[model samples]
Target: MEYMKNYKHWLANVKEEERAELVALASDEKELKERFALPLAFGTAGMRGTLGLGTFRMNEYTVARATQGLADYIKEQGKDAMERGVVISYDTRRMSYEFAMKAARVLAANGVNAYLFENVRPVPICSFAVGYLGTFSGIMITASHNPKEYNGYKVYGSDGAQLSPEATARVVSFIEKRDYFGVPEATVDPSRENVMGKDNVKLCDHITVMGKSVDEAYFDRIAKLSLSPEAVAKEGGNLKIVYTPLHGSGYKPVTEILSRMQIPYNVVPEQAEPDPEFPTVKMPNPEMPDALTLGIKLAETLGSDVVIGTDPDADRMGVAVRTNKGEFVLLTGNQTGVLLMDYILRRHKEKGTLPQNAAVVKTIVTTSLAEKVAASYGAACYDVLTGFKFIGEKIDLFQKTGAHTFLFGYEESYGYLAGTHAKDKDAVVSTMLFAEMVCYYKSVGVSLYDRLQEIYKTLGYYAEKTISVYFKGLDGMEIMANKTKALRKVDIREIAGWKVASTVDFLAGEKTYSSGKKEKIDFPKSDVMKYFLEGGDWVAIRPSGTEPKLKLYVSASATTAEKAAEKAAALLDQMKGYVE
Candidate 1:
């Protein structure tokens, strides 16, 4: 088959040590087929994979080719594209700097000015750099929370959101239309196109590539997110706090903000330094228990009242706090979002700072506890598709029309932002707000867990659960497709023991109420299914937008927290069988 020959050709391109690795992998045909067949597909988020020679792998050549494609695309737009330029930043991942510089060279070879960061930076900084420099686009080379073996490239438009649907379509068109990767070299070689006049193409192929002075201004941009440095100044060092970056890019900016606020906190040394292999964490995600093991242990050692951990890219944060009963329980991502959402708006109203046009934005799958809170403040709440980019798009809209003043935005997956300054989810801002929340509760003679109980008592108790079913390869894709199709064919009457009150299918862009009413959904079509149960409980099903898996999101509201969590879990268990 042509596929096999292509695999051999890709293998032939590897260097001495890398070729040996690919050759060793070649003995196993089944493994080799899995590795080489799919050449990594760059979706809305861009390319991500383990480092190797296969088409599906992320290696030097593939990065160069993808960079070349993006470069050619920008060049097609002419001199304006060059004037607009591209901003590049990396994280702590292995080969991240190399990829960032390689991408810069490609963009530069085509007369596009590349404003590369001198060192590793967070995702929000990359977004900030593009906007701050008045650049045309942005590139970030870091997989948000995946294991250390992985790396990714994400593109952002001039407005600072992830490339929109139309722009995404054009970029893909540019990539697919390119027929000249290895055919010929460019008229102006990429090696000599650096702003620092350093030969980036040859020296930093693997890289300490020279970078322009773009970081100080980037930091100044996110600094506008501070709503109360005075509160932080007055309450400084009153409450003890613990944090960990999980051996990633979060450490620098996170420490910078906490230090600037004069907050009393201790960083977990094991995770303070940047290690691309992520030595301290089994999984780099803050939501996962193992990822925060060292963090929790350090929190206990410091006798700290609160613990916070951010993922590798610093886009999300997970928190744990001591209960009134002296037990430390980790808060779910939904719980964290609700707490911050309630805190921001409620505090604003009390301080006479709540804007009349204030509003919050959340993904469709996030909790409705926020909806109840938003309504209580007479502010509107809008739900968009899953990614933070959708929330960013809404921010751009609010900026143009005073339709809604962007108050807060969050997702149940531990991603959040306090203000509209950074379009993307930001742990730097989250680190500041969440730590301040800890002190606020402590000053009131209660722990965060006690405050959560108060919220449960006032509003209803809310519980959320998420489960992902991994489906690999082409055959698995078919299975997942058929299973999702079947779920839409019938009305789900019961999940566990709760009666299903309504069904909403985003794929069909329709909602069917129990009373036989149907309404159209205005969002883009996605293969996600959601059901409402009696007494304000909800369950949603959709495949993972980033990974190859089917995910189940369930949220329940009840009089008691224990009952809500139990009922929510039972619902997912039964729904699994219902689908089976």
Candidate 2:
């Protein structure tokens, strides 16, 4: 914390009105300590924290430090590195613009030009820009679905994915070892401002600050991701669809793409605009049905066939489909992922484009139906560690060898990617695919809800549930860490009504096969416990990487939805007692 005590001049160059705001934050002991406590560590999902004055917080100084480290690393690569500048964009979070500018200034000060977005942008757009502009890296100021109290910085590599572990760790080492906190207040102003002053910075030949052109590129890309552009053009008028951005940056790009595809759709005007407060919804998450209640209501009133929503940054997506029973039912994230997998596989197989080297990737926590889908088509299905980054890594591997063509990738958290263009979960592409898929189903005189039932009948009916127990504050992190450790020591594993068939301890990187063979599991180390049970039911336990909560993932199969859901709910209830 003392490392930052001397850099008091950070953010000092702001206008007088903003200077007063910074002074107020500095004067508040709690805020200053929160901001100065520790450097904002980049966790699995990138850097996120409550915005304020602390080193542990998201602010001008922290962004500068991170940017400075990034710039240092880039410049150290040699003279050619100066030609590769970074692209920077921000969302609607309070002071996101100022923070982004601070980061750009730091990069500029270090001789790394930053193509700063002059306006708010969604996360996927930033990902698209990194690849489109051929930049050294990309920076997005967003907290995704987190509450308004928080903001974040997501770093993207040239391939438009999060930094690989090795690269990120190197950056972390740079950040931790630097005397970032000790940089004098007097010099910080010019150090940052001078970077943006044109003398020190050099823009990449292709890396320019783009606003609408990138959006159009994404729209064009999403159009190609469509399953049936012709069908959408033919019967799009009959396809009634409702989309809500949850009051975030998804509003503009999505609208443009849908219009370009000639797909007729209605936007929930109340939630169409980018409002960081997410006014229409209680919480801006489609995974929570409550978050989509307003959109659902609007869809119902419009008599739309389906409703879809994107998170604040438009990476993950939540959707609503009318059930077989003629009522609105929110599909779980696993359900949506599996359904998309089936849709893609089914379409490709029918079109004779199903490659012998086709591959589908999914997180282990996601539903097992993806396994069935890949097997049905004689394609390979790979289960990655539980995060889109792992899936993106798999894509990177495939891109190198052409051993397989990427068919689809998803996690059970409303994140999916079908095309190879973007490495991360892309709500823009997913949203377009969903709209096109709905159009396809409409052309066949079947609803998406009905198509899902057909999938269940073919692929064994699968049910899944997530149980979360909150462990808040610093002490809470300690307790959760301990509890996760304790689970690794337990021997007897039968739970609720299932017999443990095998177990995978991710923390220890061990998996005991039911065949009595023990093998090493090679994935990034995570504090996770997974047990596959008898009769195809499985359970996974892990603490939420982004939040202070221990989470349980349960998946089961049955002959019917009633049985599957019943068994899942009961087992989840029993597993509740295990949380510390």
Which number leads on TM-score? 1
Candidate 2 Cα deviation (angstroms), residue 521:
1.5
Task: Give per-candidate clash totals.
Answer: 2, 10
Candidate 1 — which residues are off by over 4 angstroms?
A: 179-214, 444-446
- How do the residues 1-580 of candidate 2 rate in per-residue lDDT, one tens digit apiece? 4634632644454446556666767556655544554567775456888776556777766777777677777877755665677888887767777777767667766667577764677777787788887888888888888888788888888788888888887777777666544422212333333332232233332223446666667677766766676778877877777888888878877777777777777888888877767676666777887888887898889888888899888888999989767689898888888878888888888888888899999998888877887798888999888878888889989999989899899999899898877888888888888888888887888888888888889888888898779987545667888888877767636787577788898888888866767889987777888888877688889987767789898888899989999888877887777675
Residues 1-580, candidate 1: write the lDDT tens digits: 6558767786666667777777787678776777766667776677788776676677667777777667776777788886777878888998987788677767666666776776778887787767776878888898889888888888888887888877777777777655323522224335543434332333322222333345556556556655555555666677677889888888878887778778878999988988988887778999897877777788888788778899888999999888777667898898899888887887788779899989999998899888998998888999998889989999999999879899899999999987765678888888888877766655556667877788789888888899888777745656777779988887778788788788989898998888889999898888899999887788888876666778888888888989888988888888776455
Window of ten residues with lowest summed lDDT in model 1: 199-208
User: Whole-model lDDT for model 2 versus the true structure?
Assistant: 0.77
Each candidate: what lDDT? 0.78, 0.77
Clashing pairs in 2: 3-181, 4-181, 34-54, 35-53, 35-54, 35-55, 36-54, 36-55, 108-195, 109-195
TM-score for each model: 0.92, 0.90
lDDT of 1: 0.78
